[model samples]
Structure formats: C-alpha cells, structure tokens
Target: MLGLSAFLESGRGDKLSSPVKQFIQNLLKANMEGPYGSEWPAEEKVKRREMVAPEARYVFVRIASLGEFLTTSEREKTAASCVEERGPIVGFVHFRFVIEEELPVLYVYELQLEPRVQGKGLGKFLMQLIELIACKNHMGAVVLTVQKANSAAMNFYLYKMRYVTSTISPSRVDPLIGIEKSYEILCKTFSNEAKAILEEPLELVHSV
Candidate 1:
C-alpha cells in the first residue's frame, strides 16, 4: 500500500469531477456487485442518480506518495495538493444531515474503501470521525444502511462500531415486511431521546 498518505476533503456531490464520479461508480460496483447479484444492474441505475444528487455531501480520501528526500513541510504541501488534484482516490463516504424520526441525524449513504485497505482500521477511523462531527454539530445520532447480504459489513457496524439497529428499520418495525427487504438501518445514538427512538426495538411510531 506504499504506506498510504490518505487525506480527506468534504464537498457536495455536484462538485465532484467526472473522473472522481467514475472512480466512485467503479469502486461501488467492485464491492457490491457480488452481494447484489442479479439485482446489481437495477441497483446501479438508482445509484448513478443518487451519487450525484445536489443535496448529498461527500468525503473523498486520496492517496499521496511521499518521497524520502522531501522535507516535512514539502511532503505536507505535496500531499494536500495531490489530494486536490493529482493523487489517486482510494475511498469515500457520502453522507447527508437529515431528519430521522423527527431527530436530526447524519445519514451515511456510503462508506467504501478499496479492497487493499479493508482490514486496516480506516473504516473505523472514518466512522468515528463522522460520529464526532455529528456530536459537534448537535445532531441526535449517526445513521447508515447496510446490506444483509454483506455480513462482514453488518458485523462490523454492529459489533465493532456498536451501532444498534434503528427502530425505523423494517425488521424492527415489522418482521414480515422486513423479511422481504435486503438491507438494515443502523444507528449510533447520542441522547436519551435518540437512544429510545432509534436504539430500542420498537415499531415505527412517531413521538409526541
């Protein structure tokens, strides 16, 4: 991995260049195509539209190569510049701040890393950072959707990150309906109200 120098930046989806959009589409296909199988073609049609929605924000992770001869100051500048223009992009997180069950939350639409970086704690670092942002911004919780077919991802969020399945998730609201669905909604709550509404296994009922 050449001791990856990963730098991140946040911006709206519309601001992404064509190359970066292609990178995201390719990465998503590589990671999810197998899990989605026959449904992949249809799913990708929807993703293409969602990935560029004006309201969505993104965090891009780009890799910068460092030369040993470069001074510390030079390396830092090179990295920051490469992140904006020349570096290879390795991963991204697409998110939005929205109302979930009447409480404001940061909804993670996608969090993807190249296969080479999968087991290196980068995913955890990103989620922790996202959760911190949500807390700092006074959001109630951090929410995300995970595919049931991707058991590795489900386990990662549930056990490693300690995110509970939200009450609004289909399974928690109604098992019959949830059984036919392919994904689960997960959340990490920050307040008593959020905890009760999102963490508990309750049906889909709005609070007064």
Candidate 2:
C-alpha cells in the first residue's frame, strides 16, 4: 500500500495525482450512463472533460453561489484542488469555501472519480484527508450532500469515516421529487470520549 504521505505528495499541478485522474475519468464514464433509466449522452462526457482539466486526478468537493440560489463550481483560483497518485490529472473536485458558526468550513461543492476506481476505497482515503484539512484549518467539520438513494456513499461516511447522519431533505435539481440528505460532520475533537471509546478502532489505540 502507498503511504498517505506519499499519496498526498503525489498531488501537484491541478491538485490531482496520477491515480486520481484515472479514477475520475472512469467514474465519469460509468456514470455517463446517466440517471435512473435514462441514457447519459456520450458527448456530454466529452464536455465534462473540457470543463474540468483533462488530466485532473484528485477529488475535492466545494460549494459556490450564483444568482439567488446556491450552486456548484470547480474552477480554482486560490482555495483548494484535489490531486491523485498516478500523475498530475485524472479526477477532481469543485468546491466553495464558507463559514459556519464562525468557523472555517468546506461545503462539498461537487465530486467525481475515475470509472475504473470507484469501489476500490479511494473515497474513504480522500475523506480521511478531509479530516487533516479540518485539523490544519482549525475547523469544526466537513459537510456534504448526497442523494438519498446513494446507499453505497451513505455507508462509506456513516461507517468507515465515522460521520453521523443528521437530516433528510431534497435537492434543487428536482427537489420536489427526490431527497438530499446531509451527513458526516466531524467535531474538532471527540465530543465524548466514551462515544469515542466505542467508536475507536483497536488498532488505533496504540496511536492514541
């Protein structure tokens, strides 16, 4: 296995590592099949690559604002970028920076992975990196939105990353029909050691 430090170091250029770029492309291709029962246009995938860098390889989600309602954007200026391991570009995340309760927070704007790497635990690895981001920035937690039906993602956050399920709601894109829920808010430190005790992995006991 590659060390996290080595994987983190692999990120450069567009904040994407070589491994991450390949992952994002695969994700786009697989999901390019589109939504429930609908066909995702192939040309659209081409357009997505054009919008984001062709070689992007990391997955960092962000938030943004446009018109009256909030929206998602990926173009980076001075804030953050996601880089993977293989090279400089493959997959990437788009996000907006904001404050919550007077603490710096990242509102996961958007995320994507390469098709070939979706089920190989990349998401979990990326999320742990977010914890480092929170600690480095002196923030309380990282927040993101997931569609209610994305059960696989829900399990990753609730189980692997130790995030709590908060509330269930709908999204703007067909908000009335489908629901979007927020999950996984990590506190600066464990609020309750007892809870932490039960949650802590046996292997990590030595680290503590």
TM-score of each: 0.84, 0.46
Q: Model 2, range 143-186, lDDT digits (tens) per residue?
A: 56543345666666667776653222223223444333232332
lDDT by residue (tens digit), candidate 1, 95-125: 9899988999999999998775567677988
* Candidate 1: clashing residue pairs, number: 0
Give the true-structure RMSD of model 2: 14.4
lDDT: which candidate is best?
1
State the TM-score for model 1: 0.84
Task: Give, for candidate 1, the lowest lDDT window spanning 10 residues.
Answer: 199-208
